[model samples]
Target chain A: MIGAAQLLPFSLLGALVGADVVSFPQAMLSRPIVAATLGGALAGNVAAGVLTGAVLEMVAMETLPVGASRYPEWGSASLVGGAIAGWHPVMRPGAINHGVFVGIATAWAGGWSMYALRRLNGVWAERALPAMEAGSRRAVMSLQLRGLTADLFRAAIVTAIALLVWTPINDYALAHWTVGRAAAHSILAAAAAAVAGGAIWRQSHGAAGSKWYLLAGAVLGVVLVIVA
Target chain B: MTASDRAPTTIAPALSWSARIAVFTRMFAVQGSWNYETMLGPGIGFCAEPALRELPGGPDGPAYRDALARETRYFNAHPYLAAVAIGALVRAELEGRPAGQIERFRTAMCGPLGSLGDRLVWAGWLPFCSLVALLAFGLHASPLVIVLLFLGLYNAGHVALRAWGVSTGWRSGLRVAASLGSPLLQRGPQYLARAVLFLAGLALPLAIARVIGRRGLEIPSHDWKIALPLAALFAIVLAALLVRLPARVEGWRAALVVLAVLILISIAR
Candidate 1:
């Protein structure tokens, strides 16, 4: 079991990053790559963090976060990924795979948590209506601060719960999983590639001149890769 | 008198520099208190509070109360783009415009600003930056470098947009909508969209190739093994079907489908 002392910093980090998604300071620090890296850094395993983050980043690419539509919550989820990968430390076969799996699972759960938090916020907003209607400065500030605080705690709780639930599972999977490194990596890379491809296809399929533009970008990327 | 005609008498910049800063800072919390019913309504009113407090009528006055109630009705837009609306609304309030005109202006701006912001930030900019970060990470760049690159590149565009949006809206009020329609905004997302697609195409193949190469998979050069290629072709076809399906394929479903295919491939081998 991960100690509370060890989990505390990551939980806080999750809160800050989660809040960044929609609440405040939307500086993209909440992106899976960044959040996972930070989580890994705190856990003393940067490389594992990078690996987990890169995979999660590909999956996260498809999410648009448009308007009020519910989407995967990447911030706390990446923390879960990075923490698991970091705790394992050893680059055993399927270690990164376990991290990715846990990360995706956490993200799925995080989506539901976000919906619930929104509902909670709705309740608080409802309760604050009279003062807000009266233009009470204290009331307005309190409501905003209260909403932000609620989000912070929600993220923290989600991160803590995900870590508690998944760390042992990841540890067991890493120890017992029979998948070869190359096979696991291949499946992961292909899956990520396919998802990324589908997202690009969805975005560019209808726009005029987008096909040509996509072609040009693809060529440029290939040239860069070949040169490097 | 027209809102603009009576502007000189009533719109004497009641907001101090500090008050403007407060408003701008509050813009960050425009969605802090969001709810489905009002959908940013309360948050918008909350953001406008600092300015509302500073209006000629004190906080308890009818004007301030009216303005606050007017803003809390219903409002929803991209938080970043809503800065423009906030700035314009501030001007409207200060100019003593009718609440109806202000509400109409805000309601009108919501759809366009929201859509434009969604297209530019979400669809265009995010994917492009994410691909760049993915490529950087894939190439084994330091995590710090990758993080800095993603944050720096993304925020540079977004912060500039937010600042420009507010200032432009302040200067032009509702006319700022026309300015947002400029070719630069229109072409920016289009170009970024193309770049994102291109990056995905380039990155996906290369990633698959690297994994295959690392695994020492021999196909064309060694045994003319067609299984991998066939599987890939099948995956592509599946992906195409998912994309074309009338119903939206949730992310998890797509992921499950991909994983299932991989499992089948592994079993077949």
Candidate 2:
């Protein structure tokens, strides 16, 4: 079991990255790949972070954060995934698979949290309206800062909760898993590939001459891989 | 008033270099106070505060208070493009334009700017960069290198867009919309998106194949030699079919179904 002290840094990192998603900086640091990598580093394992990040990135490709749409929140979820992948005693063949599973589940939970956070923001905004309507600059600035602080705490709590719940579940599953190494790799690869392919398909499906572009890209990719 | 009928307004060069910097920095928090009713209402007001403080009469004056009130109205846009609106509004407020006119201008620019930013940044640039980063990761590049590559590629465009949007919107006001909505600007990202999509489509299967090949699955005979190519072909076809499916099939549902099938196959084997 990971110590509470060890989880603090990850929780903080999650808070920063989560706030980055729609608040301060809007840098892609909140992205699953980056957040997961940072999470892995905090947990004292970079390789586990990278692997978990890569898989999560493929799954996240299908998401499009447009307008007020409610999509899965990958930031805190990736942190949970990376921490689990890094801390597990056995770096089993299905480790990445398990990490991806936990990451997806966390993301779904994070999505709900995001919706809740938005509602919370609405309440804050409502309370500040009298001062805001009076054209108080201090009121406006304080409200904005308060919202950011709330987002930070929201991400931290989500990451800590997810870690507390999923870490034990992941460790137990890895210990008792029956699938052989080869089969596990093959299954994960196929599923990841299919998900990625579907994401790509959705992206280019309506565009003109998309099929040709796919073929061209495939050929180029194959040639590059072969050469390398 | 008609464009020519209005007296020639002197552009207030009053916003000092430091004030502009402050506004730009504040632009980063344009979504900080996001809410359902007002969306980015308070955030927009927050960004304009620095400029309001810098007006000729200073912070607590009527002009500053009016400008602050003007900014706090319902406003939302792509966060990146909000910089454009911020710059334009700052310029307008500094020039002492009517509060109503500036608000109308902000409202008018939101929809077009939102759609344009959405297309360029979210749909085109981000996925393309992610694909490039994935390629680098697959090739065993260092994690730092991959991180740098992803951030550098995505932000180069992102930072450039924010700077250009602000500067251009400041100078041209509503006229800047013409350049923003130009087909060339739109098509450039679309073309890049297509190219990136092609590369991703090609690379994903190759990566999957490599992973499968590395696992060294045992077969009864040489019959398993065909398995790799068959799997690759099936993936490509499956991708094509999924893409061609009706919009009713959500991406998440498709992914879950595929995942379930793979799990079932693994368990049975």
Residue B118, model 2, lDDT: 80
Residue B37 of model 2 has an lDDT of 76
Q: For candidate 1, list the clashing residue pairs, or say none.
A: none
lDDT (C-alpha, whole model) for all candidates: 0.73, 0.74
Which regions of candidate 2 deviate over 4 angstroms? A206-208, B1-12, B209-234, B245-248, B253-269
Best by DockQ: 2
Q: Which CAPRI category fits model 1?
A: acceptable
TM for every model, in the order presented, reads 0.89, 0.91
Candidate 1 has an fnat equal to 0.49
Per-residue alpha-carbon lDDT of model 1 for A1-228, expressed as tens digits?
888997798899989988887887777877888888787777788877877787778778878888689988888888788778777555565656666667777888888888888888788878878877776667767877888898889889989999888877767666666655555665666566566677777876666776776677667655654555
lDDT of 2 by residue, A90-153 (tens): 4565566667777777888888888898888888888888888787888898999999999999
